[model samples]
Target: MSYSNAQELLSAIQPASGGTEIFDPATGELVGRVAQNSVADLDAAVSAARTAQPAWDALGHEERNRLLNLAADRIEANAEALAELLSREQGKPLNGPNARFEIGGCAAWLRAATAYEVEPEVVVDDGETYAAKHYRALGVVGAIGPWNWPMMISIWQLAPSLRMGNTVVMKPSEYTPLSVLALGHVLNEVLPADVLQVVAGGREVGEKLSGHPEINKIMFTGSTPTGKAIIRSSADTVKRLTLELGGNDAGIVMEDADPKAIAEDLFWGAFINTGQTCAALKRLYVPESIYTQVCQALTEVAAKMPMGVGLDENNVLGPLQNKAQYNIVADLVQGAVDSGATVLLGANPDSEAAGYFYPTTLVADIDPQNDLVTKEQFGPALPIVKVKNVEEAITHANSLETGLGASVWGSDREQALAVAARIQAGTVWINSHGTIDPRIPFGGAKQSGYGLEFGLDGLKALAQPQLIKG
Candidate 1:
């Protein structure tokens, strides 16, 4: 059945006895309901994946590559329709800087997965005794994706697992399940039955997946607290895990950087996905000399950008994905304001508005200890802090326990590169922030979580390495 929006998609599924309500953050309208899948359902999905995995692995890399490529083609064909539903449910604008961009990202990742080839590595060749290392598929992979960038992130998890010759049971976040469910439908058209499954529900379902004994590996993308819980729960079964968790990423602006030249890039780096992205620039550290100029430049650029519902073509930014997140952003910004931080733009949100809309906000002249600077707001609010020098900026940037990604901005390329190397993050950019590519590995450091995704490293993570000696 053709479904234009999330409500229609859910209606076609035949509502179960108990399900979680899904609402559009842009309009605060009930868009759909996702079945509250129980542990039994999780068991069934995992069991099915286990049964399917052996034969899938037997297909070998060549055949698997062919099928994955076909799936990518199908995804590209249906990209437009999927992008609209994603915009409606996920609250990213359909055009310009949003949903369509994510849809394209999904397709790009899938295509990249098809191109990656894994082969046996020769470890030693002493003539008398030769040794090699081969990668083999793990049984069943359980993937739990987050609300922000659901489609792309899900593809990141699923494509790699499938290409590595493993079966998957995935659960998209309760807040944005429709687009992923739709994606599952498209892939299943080309994939074998029970090879890929998408189960929708809330926290209980996720807990079940993480702890399930049958799941050989678990891949999750969400908050740091949740990642810790998963790590603890998976202890019994000891399932291999790959987590892309929370990041209070910091960006440093060197005194040599031109405020006007970098303002637009810097603004979007923080506010893209309404600042809901885990790797987005959350805390910006500017040199004391250029702090005011940097803030003014960013404020001017942000003021001109349109913010509204996702379906609007002209709107570049949309509402927070849910009310709880909206409140978090609002509360944190207020706390910063109360602490005497200067509000450069968008201090107020329309309380009477129909949606969970928080305007693109920028807070400046904030102390490092301020809650806004210390916490991960994960909404359209940024805290800009002044630093005495590059040494202070690096210190403040590395102060957070979570370090998924970071960035360094400066006109002096060599100096910026030197500073970028010192930042303690999984990924560090010299002139940009959170510029993820399909071919490069991405993950977290320290409390952010463990394991990597993307590139050969990601593929290897999905499989176990077997050493051969002859």
Candidate 2:
């Protein structure tokens, strides 16, 4: 899929923006170029949205449901191509799996949101009914998504906002903007262009869109520091905000744990997406009894994963999106080594041929207060801290500034659930890591960011109630 001609690339994109550069993670090749939105492009999109919105919104729930559902159908049709393109741009191992997960999950959200009952019922006082309640949309929602899972996150934003009757202007991360832009073109075919619009470019473009006065709300997913900055920027306008930030989630392994199974769970959970997830199980606390066995089992599993291009079926991991992440992961690994933490397996990634890849590293015996354990290292490096008992594991796991998600691994489900209950996070998985659901709400606790993205909880976030006197 080479775009030798500029016009061919131009036609592929719906609302093209300049300064967009595409790189093949496999060969580090220049795969494509994109023209980002100039001020004129932004004007056109916003005006088009402003024009199309009132009518789209006026059509009300039934029409909106039909249009959004059609958009979901279109997403299904393009699933394969989108997956391959997403892998080429962002470099996740399960290009096929990830793509399928995102598409299916997005459709589910649209379907769920369609059934959202925003009508008012009865909540009375004294002798007679004082007022009635109803929910209203928040106008245009400014959704800014991350590169790790752009398509899904965009749907995370779009599903709720559209259901609530607000129009959307989504700005995807510059590193992986193509799939999102392509979505805009697809939706235009199924639904009106105003319902879902994808606006792409670099940080400057994002800042402009996020700060636009017309935008009533902003939903973002990224690092805590960046989330704070975005909140501050949106503060002047006092935009409605939902920030999904960072996490150094802790996984607790009890003495009663089965070392072999726990080992496999720990590696995949903490190190999935090369350890790039915000809620990915990160710091691990293991009881002394099973420490040696757990370590040995994990070392072998980590060794089996091979890093290469995402398109390769057998590739276990792919490259980091860019050099900055590569350096970040590199330094974290080096720091752990200097802090008396032992690197049990693998080293800094050596990807001389293609993509920014990092080998999975399991570091043990580090002080719990060490930056490697406390800081949010979003990469394929797992650092383990030994704890005397489950109590200490619970305390240490909750010690971080961010609380996104965690896992409690043990043979005893009751014990794991009890320990998981003690850890402070939005979601805690027992005997597993990194499982998310559209029916169940997903978000973070504390600095991990606030607000839910899916399920009935998400519908509430997008809805507002109005009371009328009876």
Candidate 3:
């Protein structure tokens, strides 16, 4: 059923009392409270998942696919309500490529999972012997999601796991529990009891869930440090993990590329979701020959994009999800300013403002070693560094340890493809960045974490490969 407003959806989800209090990042008003689930709560959820998984898996792929498609239909039915709750809780505007886009993405991923073909593959059929590979359910999957794109990313983890015949126990970030809780409420309308569980909790619960012996695999999307921590916790149980961690994505603009032509795309590439996105371009390497032109074009486009509260239909961008994130963006931008970098636009925020609104900032003429360029300042601020040539641009782009995604922009497809090969990111785009497709496989390189998400391979990631030979 559809909800008329955020409150109606919030009431349907039945927010927990005497737990964690959630506030709107755009307005600093009380949104709701969620249960501060304990390690015991995680244990109960996992135990329940274990009890329900066999029956769910016994339903087999055909029935599972049908149920998942039904869940997707439910998501569409409640799309507006879900988007409204998501906008208020996550600080993403209802319009633009924010809340509504995310809601649509959730359904799209689910439908993609249903459309994917998964069956036993024949590896050999020689005269004397036969062999085939088959993928089986991995029991229970623990999906821990981050605040940014919480609902969509949770579905990215959940849909595949369920499609592969595994029950899911999800732990949403404490920052935006209501959004996930509300979304899960919608999905559970079609999902069988105990097949999917959303346990709203804190670090202890996450720690317990990661190390939980019953959890066969953990699908996590969040920070690098937290990913590392998950690695450590899972070591004891030897639990399989698909970690999509932090990214300091970089973008290169060729000297021959027209700045004005790519301005709007470049603007959204860096500032979409107010740049809180992990794959959003955080660093820009431009040829010095056209550095001024590129900066001016970006500034002109950035000036046109409106930023305000989430419910405002006119606004394309909104405030930071929380104060700590706002401060990190502020500190990184301040560090760049102290290094004598020129502020092309923004970087100034009123401390007295009610919400965590950091202006859409662009820094030019910044050193390659500056914190804003080297660190993952996941916010609306982008540091544009000028390079003498393409070689230097590629060098600076590949310098970071984290490489989730990167892009090379040029009119020449061959030249852009050549440059794209040198980057260390999992997905490298030519003339575009941060755009993802459900059919395409996505993962990371180096310390950006490992294992793939989306597409057929994503389904495989959540399943165990078994070989049948005779």
Candidate 4:
């Protein structure tokens, strides 16, 4: 069921009637059209999923795992086509850890869900009484995904739900629906009808899907504001939620760390996917002793990575996904410049350019309280703040209520580990940032949102616990 080209894949997901038109952010060229499904469409999808859950549950783990593995195989077979569509729609380079990487991650996560063990657990075994804990599927799940990594996040929401015997109805971001729709088509090649549905539309459809009474749980990944809105909408239904919201992740450079050695890792950490990642490093704190060296090294690395249209084989970074995002990035960087922050590499953008292309930018000596430092300006810009000591670094890092991820860089593992322990983020990386693995559990802390994703814990999030005593 794999397509030979992206156009063939696009044809598979196009709406019967004319729908919303999608354009490439890099070239402003039309990519394709996706069905702007309605509340009625979402309702019908939910109803179908509700009807299919029981029979899917009846097949049990063995049968379901088999199908999931088969779906992974199909994903691999169609990886090239899927990657092309993702690159065009999402504005990420095909060659870098962008489009292809995301597609690979989707398949890898599905296989991980199948391999994980979530069998019944024996709680107590006394001769007189025995108790066991079992997990049962929570009916239908509503998954709302973000635009940055649409396909991968959709799989993140759906894989565990299906593994736990729950059916899912997904709502993709209007900005990147074709990628999700294409992914859904590939997956459905192996999945049962109604077990998984992707309804692509606007704000109205998303609001209704969150509040729908039939859906037992909701999993979402996006901005903190939208996450809060969903929280309010789902209140009456009391729907279970797993939210991976906005992150202003920080990276700290210790005095003992070699600026040149860690610089490349640092650059990719902040600028990966052209700095569009939710958990990508946004704020960087460098000790005053090594601050100059660190900034220089990072600038050198950023200079080498070319930015252009996604299809180019040489470009490692692409344009902002859309004009609105481009404007946000532009405004924030301009504010920092106006506040007298020194531009280490790039702050100049061609406003008259044909595409939403902003150069990979690095701002140095910025105030700890600057809007660029405090806000989640998710783009290809990194603001470097010079700190007197690690204590000051930690204070500024933890100052923001949004703590999804953070990183501590140093030569000594023990010192890095000790510093990592104090960071308020959900997952703190030592010497690296935003390198997620399917085996490890990932989530957020404080206002960044809650509930874990990945590994065994993620499976439990989609199911209900039942205790039996004999």
TM-score ranking from best to worst? 4, 3, 1, 2
> How does candidate 3 fare on TM-score?
0.99
Global local distance difference test of model 2: 0.77
In candidate 1, where is summed lDDT lowest over 10 consecutive residues? 1-10
lDDT of each: 0.89, 0.77, 0.93, 0.95
Tens digits of per-residue lDDT for model 3 on 268-318?
A: 989889999989998999999999999999999999899999999999899
Model 3 scores a C-alpha lDDT of 0.93
Q: Which stretches of candidate 3 lie over 4 Å from their true place?
A: none
Superposed model 4: Cα runs more than 4 Å off:
none
Best by lDDT: 4
TM-score (C-alpha) between model 2 and the true structure:
0.92
lDDT of 4 by residue, 242-279 (tens): 99999999999999999999999999999999999999
Task: Sort the predicted structures by lDDT, highest score first.
Answer: 4, 3, 1, 2
What does the lDDT read for residue 258 in candidate 1?
A: 98
Answer with 1 or 2, whichever has the higher lDDT.
Answer: 1
User: What stretches of model 1 exceed 4 Å from their correct place?
Assistant: 1-19
* C-alpha TM-score for every candidate: 0.97, 0.92, 0.99, 0.99
Clash pairs detected, candidate 3: none
- TM-score, structure 4 vs. true: 0.99
Candidate 1: residue 148 lDDT (0-100): 92
